[model samples]
Target: MSALHIALYVTGGIAAYKAAPLVRAFIKAGHSVRVVMTAHATEFITPLTMATLSQQPVALDNFAPPRPSEVSHIALADWTDVAIAYPATANFIAKIANGLADDMASTTWLATTAPRIVFPAMNGHMLHQAATERNLNQLGTDGVVVAPTGTGFLAEGYTGEGRLLEPAAAQDFVTYVMSRRQGRLQDVHVVITAGGTQEPIDPVRRLTNRSSGKMGYALAAAALQAGANVTLISTTGRQPPFGITYVPVTDVRQMQQALTARFAASDIVIMAAAVADWRPARVAQEKIKKQPGQETWQLDLVRNPDIIAGLGAQKTHQFLVGFAAETQDLIANAEKKLAAKHVDMLVANDVGKPGIGFGAEDNAVVLLQSGTAPQYLPKAPKTTIAAQVISAIAAARTPD
Candidate 1:
């Protein structure tokens, strides 16, 4: 995400103390912030601290314009790319809901044309009050995005849902909201499979690959940022991003079932999972015991279903993409698979190298497609690579 100019409005609330760290979070993420605090809010968090953290003067009064020419509130409003109401109090929420502009913060909110977000922080009882609910609904109707509050201990010495969200979660929420506003894949449904499928050999043993699912998770996040409704069918148990459908599976059959259920409705499908090619012909219900005199053992194996190929054969309107993790003859093998699987695109990478692919933080891949020259993306962070792959898919999905 690009650096954004954020106009953060702080209102009077006990959660106002968190505004400093919130500003630091935005700055740490490479964004610029300008703070506007209510007089009551200043009692909780000093404007000087906000000014120091934001590296810009805090806007406290409607009449305290530094310039004699331009109105300060209007200038701040015009400069904003996104506006957020941090620790939005009941009174402040009502004022904004009713278009009441008594303070510099409210006036700037009224004047700004940027996308607006609000994070409510108040007593649980007050938050659940009919008046507060009505005000929040009104804010939503006015095109303000109301971020969900964290449920935890409140200032009243009781646990409730009115607590301010932690800094990391709050930043993630903002990122999601902004991504939705600027995304090109709005309303698109993307189904992605990730991680290495495990084939159980016995009660205590299993067969799997080196995949850690980092690339797949990165793809999911990138797809979400592009405004797609994403469904991630993963073998890993890691927590997914805030706005995606997460389906966990252990073997290729389970992954195939999950993908088949969502395939018809999906606009795009990415086969990023390192599915095992074979499974034991017979799995032992109990642990296989090693005979005292035996030096070696033999186990029969059966070929597993080719999950992505099945999807490719059945796909009608879906833009299917597959991954090829090769050790040798990367392009040759990937090109053959591209035709054999009938996928729209193939991402081929050499996993034989050390510290690059398969559980590595970075990756390099060559994009293969029919009737097009091979496009190589140099090694970079998985997140950057995922973004590039998503962009490539988006471009390919569009016709000339």
Candidate 2:
């Protein structure tokens, strides 16, 4: 899966110690984390420290980019896939609840179009105060997802409510909230194929493409975040993001069998895996050893089943999306596949391009569908492109 862009807002509180683990958890799960802290939060934990852990420069003040061409706060807003106020102090919560944007944290919170998640932490009485209660309710009214405060020992000697949530719990809550956002593909099952299926020529040798499964994994994660029931079928040894039903396959036959088993239950099927077009016609009982005099060898090849075309022809209610990676005659070839495969949409790209597509982190593609005009996706992170692709498929689905 492509890395998630997280904007974590840190505020002053003893619970601030928990923020480090929070950031670590996000990173461990393959998300990109950036800390944005209030001035007071600096006293509890150093910006340099958080920056080191997150591997991103912490934003302590909201200002324009050093270049003076772009507004820094808005840029952050657009960059964030989700905004989270971790260990939010009562003061910080009140400030945002009252429409205050005096600091970078508040300003970024106010500006972001992404979902906001707030973790309120403070002394029990402070949290129980009528004004604080009102502010918390106000935030809820504003559609901010608030995690339930855990009751435990406060910073003081006396025990009371207001403990920061456990890092793992907080992480799970954030993921759940993000999935519940608007336009969720709730109840829809999406089956996606990823990676390059290996065609074994012998026990020790195999033929495979350059696919790393980054784009397909990104699509699976994006679909999950969109609240779809995602089942990922992958051949690459790469890991998929959390929260998916994964089916692992190695060769052409296994991939075909996996897709056949899963496709019947899916609402959308994306054929992103670079399945081998041909396989060795004969299988050796063991690894084929080379003789010292053997300079040339011949192997017969046979065509593998056209998985996408088979699905497209038999698909009844499913939205079938196929992929084409061509080096020449791109448009005409993609259009021909779009028709011949009977796919609803085809995502095509030129693997010959430099630094994009085919195992790269970024890609540029042309989307061709039966009805809509061709849509071009500029070179960007695979996650962003996957999100757009998932949305287009969702938008095109016929209603019950």
Candidate 3:
């Protein structure tokens, strides 16, 4: 286990008392923790209690004297490996979401460069409010790991998803943030495809898959954090991280062309796009009208150009990865594709498995290498899986 330097920010909520136990858990896990309490949070839990548990003086204000000339907030912010806000109130959540820095807690959050996690706690109605939901969604999109609140009684006498996550779950999030391998893909170029390709059938009608592009987007973010320059080629409308270059394509042929043009420039290519396997033989000039006997109408379909196979055949020294989303004979089919496509590695998953494919945020996959037993990865957040995949790539590149 790595020695983690943690900064815990306590926000006002009925669950503020839970932060004490969390601090203790971190101490027990052999981490050095410092607690920062908002003025309102000090009402629910005293600084003495926290300082005693954390074995460090709790810094509650930006004006506090630092060990050096550095400001307390800035020093503490720099000292932390991961920062977390427990029992984040609706007001605090909005403050961070809107970039408000009225208090020490909010200011420290803005100053911290470390990965941040927030556990929200509030009244059931507040949690369900559209503004709150929007704020939470935005936070996730901004790459903050949020521990989902459990459904239970709130201090306001209502029962819903406003309770802070259990101590175990909070600790799990802390572990995750601290355990990530640092700068593993430094200076690498990663190209990824995402979402389902739309094959036009008419002016409006089209053929598409259920892919929501979560897996591909997650991979892009992970690779980016690992220090790789990422270009996400996606068909889904999901907005990628701020700095990544995104190329959107609506059909298989367009995607093939885009890949062909960009493949040689990328150091690593991950074909996560769910390109359509077939398309209408002839697209109608306009929307086909529904007639009384339209059930008898026929349409022709044709196979799409194989983008992955083309890249595989022409691939030189770069690492090429493929995704095999299968329902059955998973390993056998994936292995066949690995050989047929001449890929460096393949990620095979049973899409039919619950919570592992399509729009789901979590996934499980088997990493297939030529002549080696597939490495099984259990269902995890797409970000975690992406990091694992990138790590494997780095390992493969290491000299024997």
Each prediction's whole-model lDDT (CA): 0.92, 0.88, 0.85
Comparison by lDDT, 1 against 3, better one = 1
Number of the predicted model whose TM-score against the real structure is largest: 1
The whole-model C-alpha lDDT of candidate 1 against the native structure comes to: 0.92
Candidate 3 Cα outliers beyond 4 Å, as residue runs:
1-182
Model 2 per-residue lDDT tens digits across residues 11-78: 99988888998999899889999899998999999998899999999998865354477677888889
Pairing residues by index, what is the TM-score of model 1?
Answer: 0.93
Query: What is the per-residue lDDT of model 3 for residues 160-240, given as tens digits with 9 covering 90 to 100?
Result: 678888786778656544444456666678899999999988998999999889889888877776667789998986667
Q: Where does model 2 exceed 4 Å of error? A: 1-18, 21-173, 398-400
In candidate 2, position 230 carries an lDDT of 86
The candidate with the higher TM-score, 2 or 3, is 2
Give the count of colliding residue pairs in each prediction.
0, 0, 0
The TM-scores of all predictions, comma-separated, are 0.93, 0.64, 0.62
RMSD of model 2 against the true structure: 9.6
Better of 1 and 2 by lDDT: 1
- Candidate 2's TM-score reads 0.64
Residue 159 accuracy (lDDT) in model 1: 86
Question: What lDDT score is found at residue 225 in candidate 3?
Answer: 62
